[model samples]
Target chain A: MLRINNLHVKIEGKQILNGLDLTVNAGEVHAIMGPNGSGKSTLSHVLAGREGYEVTDGQVLFNAENLLQLSPEQRAHKGVFLAMQYPVELPGVNNMTFIRESINAIRRARGQDEFNTLEFLQLIREKAAQLQLDEKLLKRNVNAGFSGGEKKRNEVLQMAMLEPQLAILDETDSGLDIDALRVIAQGVNSLRSAERSIILVTHYQRLLEYIQPDFVHVLVNGRIVRSGDKQLALTLEQKGYNWIIEEDAA
Target chain B: MKSPVQNAQLQTPQQRQQLQREWFQQLVVGAEVDAEYDPDWLLPLREKALQSISTLPLLNRKQEAWRYNRVDNIFQNSFDPLFDNDLEQKICIEDIGLPAIDSYRLVFINGRIDLSLSELSELPAGVILTGTAEALRTIPDQLMSSFDHLHQPGEQLFTALNTALFNDGVYLHVNQSVTLDRPVEIIYLNNNLTRSEQHVGSMIQTRNIIDLESGASATVIEHFISNNKHEKYFHNNFTDINLADDSRLRHYRIQDESRLAYHLSNVQITQHRRSRYFSTCLAFGGLWSKSAVRVEFQAQQAECDLLGLYTVGDQQLTDFHLDVQHRVPSCRSSEQFKGILYGRGRAVFDGRILVDRQAQHSDAALTNDNLLLVRDAEVNTKPQLEIYADDVKCSHGTTVGRLDPEQLFYMRSRGIAEHSARKMLCQGFATDIIESFELQQLRDYASEKIAHTLNSVESEMEHKNGH
Candidate 1:
């Protein structure tokens, strides 16, 4: 479903992702674990088509289409979702209003009919119930004054609402308490399906215990050094990235 | 039909003054104020105003007050000062869409009251609602105080012109201890475009008086709109609102005139002990327009809020000037104005808050926020705070910015197209002010208008920026 071929990207004349290569098939969950500054978030941002990232070399393909050429919104319409580590807070825009606009926009671009007020309320209520998000929080400004835990949960709720074909959860487990992490993992677990793919970019292996990945790739210096089953995550979590760096160096 | 001014680019101040006097003479000759709405007492004021028009300096970019607000177009255009007294031409409320509310409406068509279209039959006994001409004829003495409180022609050229050549408008007086349940609406429809007979542009001057006696409370809405979308005209209005002790007045104004028209409006409000005056101004039309609001707190424990939202696009120029005076102790005044400028559109916002020495414990603040979409679109926002009292809390701030890129990208990354995302943010910027409208219908109506105007503006702006 997704392929990144030697994607060498830079920002502000500084290289971030160097010769990175990864491919994910349908229904597969890939957990890319690495130490800090290993281009984990950079990969997510590149896939999402954020500006300021210079794609100096290589291209990203999704469903036989070059994704780098598309605008962020076009990529979104084509089922690319990036759950940022920090969701920008919109002070005046309500959470529910943003969700409704996002859903309808994606649907319209895909040549589907828009949802009216009543129909939208029903769908949002059903999805929001699965996430167990507080109804009152949905009425407030988007992520304004939200706690760290709540912000992450809101992203998961968006993932559920957008129902993207491929979602890049960039450090979704960062800064989340154990209980908040559990709720987010549950929400992600409920959305997993045979045709959907997810790339979990994290620094810890704790999230993998909640939603096990089909492949665990150890990313070192912007390249995938090792690809194995879920056991690779446990080994890295226990021993850390020093041995992996030494092996890559050798 | 021939352009009024042959050599409008006068060389010197003397030449400009001489040319202005000639134009003023043409307006005054046809005004015939003494024969219509003017009373015996107002004649001397008119004479003084006529004299002042000759001596008062013409507003130019050199003056401090007129630095950012352009009035050069006023001198270049010819305005037929004759009242649109073709009362025989019948029209409906829908013919000119404005004052979207329908409660005891006092409709004015072309600077005169169309009594047939005006409806106030159900007015309560304590409430007095009539046309300015009707009020002047029957209650001339009652109107004398309004003129006395107004700015003399010597102080401002346009105010003086309006005082000298004013024809008709709304006269609302709510008695003491009376709470008018229904809002009173004044619709100023400048509708000379349909009448092709009007080859030369028309000049309309209206003097509206709203007086609420002690303990009185009412909501008043003023809508200035034009039926024809494209035609040159001048509409100048002066609204005086007096709130007696403990009186409360909720004022909302919508100025959506012709795209080719010029408008100048001033709303002066005086609040007494413990009175509350809430005003919302939404102005987004006219080729060149300026809306000034001045509020003075006369007694202790009073409060006032002046909020406005404007969107200037294409060849439009929108300006708002606010002056709030806190003279008594324990009074509060706040002004928040937002502007969106696109294309070659321009906007000017000057907000001044004055806290006098006697106004201890007063809380005053002013904020002006603007969004300049295109490179050519311009905005000048200045917020001034003058505080003399030691214990007063006063602050003023302003921001002239484009859309926050991160905020835009956040919405765009969520599957919302760039156009929809831009429109949503711009509308959201206006939502805070639109929601301030006490009327729900007005909120809905203003939002629809804002969205409609803001839709194409962003894409047009993006296209412009690409170059």
Candidate 2:
């Protein structure tokens, strides 16, 4: 469902992602483990078509369409979702209103009828129950004054509602406790399907214990130095990225 | 209808200036000292005001207060200050969500007060609510003290002009130790019949000089609105408020005039010992509008809250100038003004908080936040704090930024389009002040109006782009 060929991107005239290549098919959960400044977040931003990142080289194809050519919102309409590392607080935009508008936008862009308020509320209730999210939070402003755990859960709730074709969870487990981590993983596990793909980007391997990715890739200095099955995650958890560097040097 | 040339000639600049202040000067011309109420104190004050109006000249763009607003277009409007004595105009008094009390509501149309709609007898026994003309006749002694207290005649050109030619407006005074449950609503409507500008100057003053014998409270809603959106009109207003010891007053001004109208207003408030004052200024319409509010805390333990919200679009221009003075010890003052400028619209906010010497332990802050939606739009923001007291906490901040990129991306990733997401962000930006209103109905009404404003602007842009 997604393909990246030698993607090299630069931000603020400094190279962040250099010749990074990855691929993911439908119905698969892929985990990218990297230390700080390994271009993990940059890769997610590039895939989501965020502006200000100049593409120095290569192409990112999502379902055979060049993803880099679309605007951020247009990329969103194409079922590409990026869960931010730090969720920005929007004090006046109601969570429910934003979700409904976003759902309607994607639906309309895909030649589908929009959901009315009643129908949208019904869908929201179901999603809220699945994600263990407080329904009152939907009525309040989007993540305004929200705790770290609540913001992460809210992101998952959005993912469950929009039901994106490719969900990129960027450092979703950074600030979450064990309970929040399990809740977030449960939300992601609930949305797993044959027609959708998931990318779990994290610095630690603990999240992989809950989501259980089918494939794991080690990112070092903006390049994927190693790729393997779930065991690679356990190795990284035990030995960390230094072992990977030692192996690469050998 | 038969003489088009004559009609065109009558709309000249000299004809427009002739209608400036008819009833105002007539009050001065027919001055009679009543034994019951003396006009002695106001005579010299009036003479000084007339001289000030004549010497200071009219507002020009060179002046900072009139920046981004056109005073020339407003001056070209011909006004009729003569009172309509027949009392034939309709009086419509309908409640629109604001609380109602036994307080009398004086309605004015085309600068004429309709006394028939007022119910002054129902007010509390000691309270006084009457027209300025009637107060001059019956209780001139009480009016003489507070008439020109805060509104210095020559200090402001418009107020000077209004004072030199003043006429019928509401005169309200709440007795000491009286706490009113409902607010006094003064409805000022501009019913312009000709293409000329509608000019109005209303004043409110207290009686008896009783300094609110401890714990007096009152609320006032002054609404200045115009019905005709297509006419070239002007509404220049001035309000002077004096809060005595341990007294509290909540003043709200809602200005929704015509887009072709030029609206200028100035509010000067002075707080005595232990007095608290809250003022909210909301401006939503006009081709060009400017408002200046100056609050002076004259005594110790006084507090002042100054809040303003303005939205401008198209070729519209809006300006808000606030000057807060903490002149005494332990006085606290805060000023927050937020606005959104879209299209080629321009908005300027200049606020100053001054803490004088001996005003120790004074806490003063000023915040100005603006959002620019279009590239062509402009916003000039300056928040200043001049503190002379060493032991004072004074801070000021000004933010001129676009919508947060991360917030926008989060909304879009949820499926909202770019335009709807932008509108929602803008709504959130201004909701901080709208929610500050304690009244639920008022907050909801403000929220709905803000929503409609954003949606209409979006639709207008869409329509303009269709061509």
By DockQ, the best candidate is: 1
The residue-level lDDT of candidate 1 at A165 comes to 95
Q: Candidate 2 chain B: worst 10 consecutive residues by lDDT?
A: B201-210
- Clashes (backbone N, CA, C under 3 Å), per candidate, total 0, 5
Candidate 2 lDDT, B155-257, residue by residue in tens = 2666765555555566767777788666676776665434322333212211212223346787776766664666444555666567888899877777776
Give the per-residue lDDT digits (tens) of candidate 1, residues B218-314.
Answer: 9988888887787667888888889999999999988888897888888888899999999899887898998888888999989998899998888
What fraction of the true interface contacts does model 1 reproduce?
Answer: 0.75
Sliding window of 10 residues with minimal summed lDDT for model 1 chain B: B1-10
Best lDDT goes to which candidate?
A: 1
Task: Name the top TM-score candidate.
Answer: 1
Which residue pairs in model 2 clash with each other?
A102-B415, A102-B416, B24-B165, B24-B166, B37-B141
